[model samples]
Target: MSNLAIPKNKRVIGQRELVALTAFMMSLQALAIDAMLPALDEMARELGVAEGNQRQLVVAVFLLSSGVGALLPGSFADRFGRRSVAMFCITSYALLSLVIALIHDFTLLLVIRALQGVLSAGLMVLPATIIRDRYEGDQMARLLSLVGAVFIVVPVLAPSLGQAVLTFAGWRWIFVVLAAMAGMAGFWAWKRLPETLDPLDRQMIELPVVMRNMTHALLNRSAIGYVLGTSLLIGAVFGYVNSSQQLIGEHFGMGTWFPIVFGGTAAMMVLSNLVNSRIVERFGARRVSHTGVLAFIAVSALQVLAAFRHDGDIVYFLPLMATNLALLGFLGANFGSIAMQPFAHIAGAASSIQSFFRTFGAAVVGLFIGQSYDGTARPFAIALLICSVLALLLVLYSEKGRLFRRLNAPAKPETKPGGVY
Candidate 1:
């Protein structure tokens, strides 16, 4: 049966609307992170922070909490519905933004940011869950790539948008802008997002049942391998995000031009995803993503060599770094879709579990990378290569030493009341 064999009522919208809405929902997280880059210095200053590197904590703490937060919402979405959990997350994210804007103490701000991340974890998990509820395999990878193509726009533009706000209304207004954007996405979601979980597939909220489901998700060999692989890759990306402002705006001295340079690099992500969206259906997720992993390792090596140069020419650094990020565009959606290929019955729990590993593990790894910054790009570059190599090893394990082979398995077949499994 077609995965798209959703009931007419549940398939409430067209493909374009579904992609747009999901992308917007996911982009909120990106906006919250990337848009705050330019404001970190001022935020640190007003909050009376002394060390320059400590400013990275504002983003780091949010990411750490977000990792922990990923564990909750999916189980609820599985029990209640995707829409309700999603709306709750969006509303809370907006409110938290407002609350954080008014916070004076740095500790208080970090606490609030952590709370916001916990709630906002749904923003990351639910969209993928929602997509999984409707698609699978390479088709799923293509759709996710399309969603990523749209979602990457937030990162491309967010630093610039934040800089614009910082130029006029000050940094606090950046939170206001985030609140407004969340409100908008939430409104659209409230009105248009369908409950994708079929009633028959709904899992109970009981602890044992939830644990069993999560255990199944965790134990799946392919899923865990891909999940860990993506986590390392995601950590590498977050490492860059954690130090982007410092590296580009401060060390390389782009200063006010940081946004443009950052956005330009981010634009590579947008382009890569767009290209992946177009070709993934033909080449398969494993082939595309494995190739990307190799290229990422190669590029990271170049980045490291460039970092050691006396001049550390921005000319060489920017392109290599951008290429590495662009490679991630191919890996992210494909790895996620492949990890999710086996869990049609427990999409929500599986997504939640996978998201927890991907986000939480990445957060820890990213923190290490960020804190390792020594006013040189060497640490970040080395982290990228190490992550890519480790990711390739995990992928090899998942594929049992194979690469570029298709995952011929479909999701476990379902049995409706009148049908057989």
Candidate 2:
């Protein structure tokens, strides 16, 4: 099983199994992030968090730790094996979730949550590296799109699940459920997932080497642009996730019905993922992503207009929010794939650095924007607009002013002197 060579004729993984595993792995992040939303107020009250904004620190702390985790896990996965690292990470995360559930104090809870993020980063980075190891070009995009389609459903259901747990048990029970889910996921990976990294390709994990590689990724124009572009897009998403429960429950007078509304909007993202999958083979990732970015800008602009015009009515709010989020599914997968296109040799390191910047950077930006919750959707909409603009600009720059170019362009074989990627 360790050295099972995937034949070109036989599929790397059965489509159904690949979708199932990817969905499960990807859901780790969504469940961790989204399920906490409904419980934020309750947790804050329970812990006596001083500022309403401080509750957001719980989420921010997790993402910040994810950034730290993202940088190093890639090298470990490359050196060891994807399956081993993934199982270890998930087991750690599940244990941390249990710790979070048991914690009574706010500071301790934050520390536990951050550790959970660090552990969860293995799930996030290893899957993409495995996908790359298995597939490339259109096939890779299709696989990612399939995973994206499934991943969207997690967020759709998470808040609803959180609300249900809140109703029957308590907020602590939500973390209990998360711990159970993480344990199950880790067990599945250990039992079913095959190692994809080749021992010959493994590199010595060194601090200087990791730092040098990271600096190369950050300084590379295309990599930098893709990182920033994805970060901004993620920032918008984080802002929404942070505020959705409050807006729907408190402002829109939805209460328990909040998850239904939230889930409904989230379903639209599935539609977007389906659309991306359909067109990615024909039109390619860059074209599809560019169109998505433009659409996001338009949707955000309209939301801003409607907010100013009607003072944030739910009638105008829901549709705009749905459209904005739907567009995110389009940006999420393609940007990472495209960014890593040039860094195949050190895919693990590149993945780690890119994931760190995108997730943690987005968390920082989103936390800042989310703190300005004025009992309206205006701030969220405005943040989306700004992120969209920045993302669009960076995408243009990343593609060397050719935003619509197909991602399948033949690689230039010339090596850059001393470049780590």
Candidate 3:
């Protein structure tokens, strides 16, 4: 059914190209964050950050600002077009990376990172909005999962890349590499990415119109519940990323192998997302994600138990943590697709608003979890369990207490006649 619904002759790019491009564009966010993980300690020392937990601000501040910045690009995209806004954001991101590479002051670096995050957030928001311009419902979930499978490659390799840079060229050059990558991505987008916003569906950029559209998207019962739920899940993941270097490298005595260990855990998500893309259409996004959430809670419970043992045994901790993180592959794309179901007409504004909540919520929760790190995994474990359980409740609320039932009335695209859906 989803296969038959493909928007034929509408895309300037092929399906495979679209998926790969969107995934690479999305991967930029991951690369920006993850590539800095291995270098955080070095960055801390150079920037005069004496406290250990403060280093997390480098990542956390960017995430927080990205969330806040997510609100603008969508409305602009809705007014102008996705391609123009995306191009502007990508170029700004590269330029900011260049600036950060030259900065010496810790506060100055963080300020630029925050600003960069705001500008670059469109890189995260626009891809999903573009996908929504082309597809929705379970088919959208499948495509997003495919995107996730590819995006996970960055997390798998970014830490190692950071480590290699740190080994040879020092931490500041990490930003130089980021600038180069962003330039490449921006160039690809310029050459190949199409304007996905149909003229008929475009909204005015006036404050009132933007607010109304944003309010409508947020007020939708099904959408907000899933939005909040997914936020918590991703928040927990960000928390892990925040403290992962210290946890794996310093506390576990795996200093040199941190990238390999971190990347190995991230690799699990690649497999899970691949499986999700394959099965999501058959089982439905709700059932697959619901099952995944339940399994997540179970694994999270064991993680809490493992952390409580105070054994500090990497052998037991690594696999359990990896499994728990992998479950996000099942939840993220499905939850996002479901939340965007009723907003086909205002995909840009809706995507931006939802992205704001998701990213902002995750950033706050993750910052707390990251700062709560006590040279042990207990804080992380407890936070994951709490997030998973709350997520289940939110999912239940979204479905009116139902768990595994599929959504029968899938949303129809509101595109005009002869326009891309």
lDDT at position 191, candidate 2? 67
Give the alpha carbon lDDT tens digit for every residue of 221-248 in model 2: 7767878998988888878877877877
lDDT of 2 at 77: 76
What's the TM-score of each model vs. the native? 0.87, 0.84, 0.86
Sort order, TM-score high to low = 1, 3, 2
lDDT for model 3: 0.86
Question: Which portions of model 3 show Cα errors greater than 4 Å?
Answer: 1-11, 36-58, 102-109, 165-173, 245-257, 308-311, 373-379, 412-421
Query: What TM-score does candidate 3 get on C-alpha atoms?
Result: 0.86
lDDT of 3 by residue, 1-421 (tens): 3332233333477667889988888888888888999899999999999999999999878877887999988888888888889889889888999999999999999999999999989988998888888777788899999998898788778888899998889898999999898888888888888777666677766787888888888778778889999989989998998899898898788999987898789888898998999999899999999999999999999999988885478987899988987898999999999998887678888899999999879878888999999999999999999999999999888888998988667666433212222
* Stronger candidate by lDDT (1 vs 2): 1
In the range 1-421, model 1's lDDT, one tens digit per residue, is 1355463564377677888998998899988888999899999999999999898889878877887888899889887888899999999999999999999999999999999999989999988888888888888898899898998787777888999998898889999999999999998988888888777677788787778888888778877889999989989887887798898888888899987898788888889998998899888998999999999989988888888883346888888988987899999999999998887777888899999988778878887999999998888888998999999999999888998997566756532211111
